[model samples]
Target: MIDTRMIGDVRVTRIHEYSGPTHDPKFLLPDLSQELLESNREWMSPHHWIPLMNKLILTVQLWVVHAGSNIIVVDTGVGNRKPREGMARMHNLNSLVLEWLEAAGAPPDKVTHVALTHLHMDHVGWNTRWLDGRWTPTFPNARYYLPQDDFLFCESGRNKQEGLDVFGASFEDSVMPIVDAGMSVMLKPGMEIGDCLQVEDARGHSPGQVAFRIRSRGEEAIFSGDICHNPIQIVHPEINSGYCIWPDQARKTRMEFLASSADRETLVLPVHFGNPYAGFVRREGAGFRFEPLLW
Candidate 1:
């Protein structure tokens, strides 16, 4: 079933692509503490962590927000039939993101805008589709937004993604097609969409990554894409994901976002969080905690 919720009149839903053990805690998150995991097993077991295999569970899902007359889809998960290498789990696969969107009542062509947090292969795969040997924009009628810095860096072949053979084709397949189709709008750090949405410069995971903030009727929510890959990072905010291009900056941005979420009581929805992919951040000692929320 498609999980639905509302922050004022904005109808929000989650369209999942895949949900399972995407990586080992040690490999993806280099600074995970075994001691913390063992102590927190009572709450983390079977949901966030698989202690037996020492694997961290994650979800690749899309956040669909229906605000005013706009249907904004954030961070499309890996789509079907991409020649993904190195990243074996996401390589050349089929996903139910579109079907689930339909079930949730947000069909493809009806989507007015599609926004990406960054240009990573996993995050932007659905921006285009493989059709008749050509990569094409999957959302034919939607205006796509991408971070200007990321688009430039990746296009220059200087970004970390370019060095990795597996993601070498990502820029061409996922980003260029949108730009070529005249559907991509390169945005800077602080662009606001109407009065209900804005971009937060949350770099680190990528050289030019950003997060989305939405507000309506005095309520607030943030789509914090890839800042914190695991629930453990809420407590150990210092840990950097293997994919982070700017580790120091990523950690700093993460800390700031978490603090803000805790203080403002904003609903923090992440792209790769499991099941109840969102929650409220709370003060827990010197760090913070994720309070899973479902609607």
Candidate 2:
């Protein structure tokens, strides 16, 4: 299913890729306490957390933004038929991401730009599709904006050496093809796309992870990628996901983003948030609260 919302003149549409019970609350967020989980259980049950299954629900999705003539795609989800042996959930499977994008009103061909928050397997998988005989650039007309640090890091094959084969394989099949096709552009902090989307430093989840800030007519929203996987993090910013490479930095980034979003009343659209995916962060006492955008 797709959810559409207007942020001033820019139209934002979320195209769903995958959604289910993903991880254990304690497993995903090691810093979370049972008391805290139980405290928030009333509001989190069924949507963000499944008490019966002891799993944290997550959704893998991408955002399509329409800014005048620019058809921008925010982080692509895991693509069809990829070798992700290390991560069972992302391994050799087929998903109708392209069809969903089309249904969301932004087809692959119409996508003018692709902005990736990081180079993780799930975020960059749809960069290429198995076409003809090999992996090919899925968005042929789009110039893919990739983080320079991550591109260099993944290109160095260090992730594989460090036993992150899932990311390495994804880089090989998904990202490299974009570079080989000469459609890749290095993204930098404070970079603006079409005068509405601005890139901000959001490193921590990955070395070069960044977030996009969309603004128009005084309204704003942040396409935060994996900074906080679930809304639970809004109330507990210190809890870092197990996948975070730099825990300290990740926590700091999350806290900062949450505080800023709350102060500015900006919409928070994280990649792994459950249904009614986007929301607003509001300051509550010493922490924050998530106000889901139900419309």
Candidate 3:
């Protein structure tokens, strides 16, 4: 289960997963390739890696006001039976995500929208469910938002040509189900679905990756979906992950995101971090740090 916070009139719910030690160590912010290559060491010890309070890693669910009406889920995590073997071992999808959603009072029908930050498997798994031996969009009444660039990248020869069918079925089974049902829309950056929520292109992890910014009653927060995996990356913005398609581009994107939210007033919702849904970016010694929101 996760905590729920209200920003202005919007009730922001965070569905967290205590996926300690199950995730790939490399995905940790300090283990990014750029940071690894710069340092001679292979990894950081547990002492150096632990958070200030010795906390564990926590993933988040960002629920924004749906078209200023209801709620929209951003980036559903790995769902059940997602083929988690070998390199993808860490990509396991359990029912807790959906359970947490229900616990937070959001049933499958309650979620009216699912915004895919990118076409990555981990971000899109829960977009659909396995039913009658086929994958189908989880939300019947909701529309799935896909960035045109990301859709093309995934559907193109990128994964299939290499015989890597990890996230392929998700688009076809989960996303396309909604699309065929007329519930999916290919969106461009800066598209406004409502008065409160807006999509912005923060590409680089993927060609057309985007982030959602939700503003309500003079207070605003950005659902930074996978742009930076952990808080440590905020301090070491130059780091690049192995999955990063373009290292340089990813770096630039992260920098821009940091700059945009560096101010104390802005709430940054990092999709995968230990705790605190929103945080204030602060200038530390040589780089920036994420100061988690107290409330």
Count clashing residue pairs per candidate.
0, 0, 1
User: Clashing pairs in model 2?
Assistant: none
Q: What is the C-alpha RMSD of each candidate to the true structure, in Å?
A: 1.7, 1.4, 4.3
Q: What is the lDDT of residue 19 in candidate 1?
A: 85
Candidate 3 on 1-295: residue-level lDDT in tens? 5766676767777776444433444544434554442342222223124323333254545453434466688777767666556644334455577777777777788877777788776677777777888777777777788888878777675756645354555676556666677777897898965455688988877778888887778777787777877665777788755556766898999998888788536688766665555578887676787677786
- Which candidate model has the greater TM-score, 1 or 3? 1
Error of 2 at 280 (Å): 0.6
Order the candidates by TM-score, highest first — what do you get?
2, 1, 3
- TM-score for model 2? 0.96
Give the clashing pairs for model 3: 79-93
User: Any runs in candidate 1 off by more than 4 Å, and if so which?
Assistant: 160-167
lDDT of 2 by residue, 38-76 (tens): 899988988999988889998889899999999999999
Kindly provide the TM-score of model 1 when superposed on the true structure, using C-alpha atoms.
0.95
> What does the lDDT come to for candidate 3?
0.67
Badly placed stretches (over 4 Å) of model 2 are: 161-166
lDDT of 3 at 151: 81
lDDT of 1 by residue, 1-295 (tens): 4688898788888888888976787787777667867887876767788888888898888888898888888888888888877778888988777788888777888888888888888889888888888998888889898988888887777865456432357788888989998998887778975345698899888877898898878888888989988777887799888888878999999999999999989998898876677788899888788799967
Looking at model 1, the pairs that clash are none
Worst lDDT run of 10 residues, candidate 2, spans 159-168
